[model samples]
Target chain A: MKAPRRGLAALAPFLWLGVFFAFPFLLVAKLSLSDTALAMPPYAPQIDWSKGLAGLAAFVRALDFETYARLVSDRLYISAYLSSLRFAAIGTGILLIVGYPIAYGMARCPPAARRALVMAVILPFWTSFLIRIYAWIAILKPEGLLNAALRALGLPALDILDTDVAVYVGLVYAYLPFMVLPLYAVLERQDHSLLEAAADLGCGPTEAFWRVTFPLSLPGVGAGALLCFIPMVGEFVIPDLLGGSKTLMLGKTIWTEFFANRDWPAASAVAIVLLATLVIPIVLYQRQQARILEAGR
Target chain B: MKRGPSFFNLASVVLGLAFLYLPIVLPVIYSFNASRLVTVWGGFSTRWYAALFQDEQMLDAVGVTLRVGFVSATLATLLGTFAAVALTRSGRFPGRTLFSGMIYAPLVMPEVILGLSLLLLFVAFGLPRGVWTVTVAHATMTLCYAAVVVQARLVGFDRTLEEAALDLGRTPLQAFLEVTLPNIAPAVAAAWMLAFTLSLDDLVIASFTSGPGSTTLPMRIYSQVRLGVSPEINAVSTLLIGLVATGVIAAYLVQQRRRATA
Candidate 1:
């Protein structure tokens, strides 16, 4: 009796997730097999089981290695993908460089001061994301605050808006909190005795950090990197708003295909490809998280 | 380990904090600027806040957003708490691993992909996309967050209290109410708050599912920002920031007080 009741309870969420979330993913995969012409209102395609196999065959036939081939040769998609990767990579790098020290300082502070400092870091996040991005427009635009200050200082006015630099800046600014919070959490829990032990052995402050503290903080670094990198890879608003019309990235491409072209199949194809690319990093991060949790236990 | 105060650390912290706050601070400052040109700082005034209060579209969007958030957060929290209880306390079932993975997929999946897939599903079902659809979509996504928080709380809990109550001849339901509920109430509250915040913040999924008449506050803000910066947006953002900050602080203080008492 207990077993049955427990089984039913355990099964409840899975059933809900299967019906809602998993089912939609399967639907997308299934729809990807159907012909684009079959994508009309009451959007369910009439599936003949035999014809479904044929439709799958047709979908494979349409695979047009040309898309992937073009993806390689076509400078636009290739460059955009590269640029996005570059932006995410560099942005994550900068966040680490910038966020680590701050998180360390925060960790070293007294508990009350740490909480207040962390709250200050998080205060900006309370505002709408779009509004914060919009605020960046006022600061980064050609005639905006940054440029105005530059002009006043007798420096050349920089047109930072709609540039790759702006994209990097925007991404890093947006995601720094993700980096800081995780790093802070890890560092706060760190055993200060380890550092003292290293110091008693005549190790310098820098050497002590590298030898003892840094190695221990690797998990936090990994966690923070994953948090920053994964979302930045698929970021839409920053690229669209700050990168302007000139910058073409996967997120904007997928958005246009779904909304403007109304090609669900092609859009699904793009999403699948993006997901496939992201899966490796996500899997690695999950494994790391599991290890961390295991260690905590 | 008594290192002198490092200037490098101090300077970096100051710079990093400035970077985080600049955008927020600029908007707040601009909201009071009398000039329409966001780049120029004219004399300060409360005109933008006055204008924001008068904007019918902004008011309507806020109303719709609050309604959707309220419904979705409550539903997601309930479903999430149910799932958390089941998974943490119950026996294993077939496809238990698969079910766990599916529940978490929404949390990590790109919102764009989730939005696209849901939009297609709605179309496939011949369901009209609107406020109700948005609520369902938001609940689906926010449930994962609620589940994760509740699961974290459940991990530290001692289950023997409930078992002891059961052994004392109370029914399972009665034991749960009398023993388990009180212990995990904090987690439930945290889960609800998390779900509420997530539902309030969601834009992409809501964009896909909401109709013309059901535009959410974030959607409205996105459209406004797309054109250019506006003082009214600044006023609205400041208000939202104030509200969320207050809530977070209150929650933190309550948690601290509980910890002290415990």
Candidate 2:
């Protein structure tokens, strides 16, 4: 009775996941296999024995290294990929630089003020995301607040809109919270005695932080970097809003292919490649998490 | 321990907060600016807010977004709570690693990939793109967040109370209902609110799955901003900012009161 009841409970979540999550991916996999034109109503599941394999053959033909070759050869795709990497890397770096002090302060704050400090960090998130990005437009445009302020201060008005810099600023602004939260989570849980010990060993304040605090915060840093970097790589809204029409990112390319070109197969092909690229880091993170869990046990 | 106040730390914190707040504050301030151009403040007025109230498309989008958020948040919370309870209560199981991975996958998957894949899935399955599709996608993503928060609460939960209730002749269901439910109610409530906010703020998946009539508030805002940032968007954003602040403050106060009592 106990075993069956346990088994039933365990099976419930998997069933839910299989139906909702796994089924969608499987459908995508199937769609990627069959010819797009033939995938309509009265859907054919039959396969020719002479064709050797069903989905496999379809997948092989669709896998046409052509798309991959195109992605590599095209200057647009190559440049976009490189720019996306640069944006993600630069954004992550900026977030770490900006977030570290805030996280450190919050972690060290008095109990009464800690929650309030954290609240401030999370306060911007309350507004709709698109609205927040829109706010940047009000600030970053040529005639926007930023340039107006610069002109008022007797400085040359810097035209930031539609620039890579604007995209980076927006990406960092949006993702800073993700970086801070994880860093704060790890930092707040740290023992202060370790820092004190370092200080007592004749280490200066900065030295203490470098030697003791930074190493201990690596997990949070890694988690934060991963969180910010992963999504920022494929970020659509920021680049779309701030980068203007001329900027080409993989996300914009994918969107145009699906909505503009109506090339569903090619779009799926791009998506599959993007998905495969993301899966590598994710698998590594999962393995790391598993190892951590194992060590804890 | 005897170190003086660190002005460097203070300066950095101040700068970080300024960077985060300036854009948010500028829009709120400009919502009242009488000028058509966002760069200049001719005079302070509530005219844009008045205009926002009159926009039919904006109002319709808000209604659609609210409906989607409500249904998705409630359903996701329920499902997440069930999964959390099952995972926590059942000591060990086969494929546990796989189960955990499935739950976390949505949290990490890029919205672009998830959105495109779901779009393909909908097309393949012959499901019409609409509010229902958007809700399903939002719930799938937000459920993972709800699970993580509730699971955090469960990991620290004392299970002996449930065991005692069972020993006192309560059925397993009664024990769970009477004992476990009361204990974790706060986390469940928090999970629901978080899920709701997430569903409300979502744009990418909503953009992918929503049809003509199902455009959400964020989708509408994106469309408007894609053209140019209008004063009306500032007014709407100001109102949204107020709503979120009020909700967050209320949650904070309630949590504080509960902590005080405890």
For all predicted structures, in order, the TM-scores are 0.90, 0.91
lDDT of each: 0.78, 0.79
lDDT of 1 by residue, A48-73 (tens): 35777897665456543333444467
Count of clashing pairs, candidate 1: 0
Specify the highest-TM-score model's number.
Answer: 2
lDDT of 1: 0.78
- What candidate 1 gets wrong by more than 4 Å, as runs, is A34-75, A290-297, B3-5, B91-93, B252-262
Candidate 2 wrong stretches, greater than 4 Å = A7-13, A30-66, A287-297, B3-5
Once model 2 is optimally superposed onto the true structure by TM-score, how far is the C-alpha of residue B186 displaced, in angstroms? 1.4
Write down the TM-score for model 2: 0.91
True contacts kept of each: 0.51, 0.52
Provide a comma-separated list of chain B TM-scores, one per candidate: 0.90, 0.94
User: Model 1, residue A269: displacement in angstroms?
Assistant: 0.7
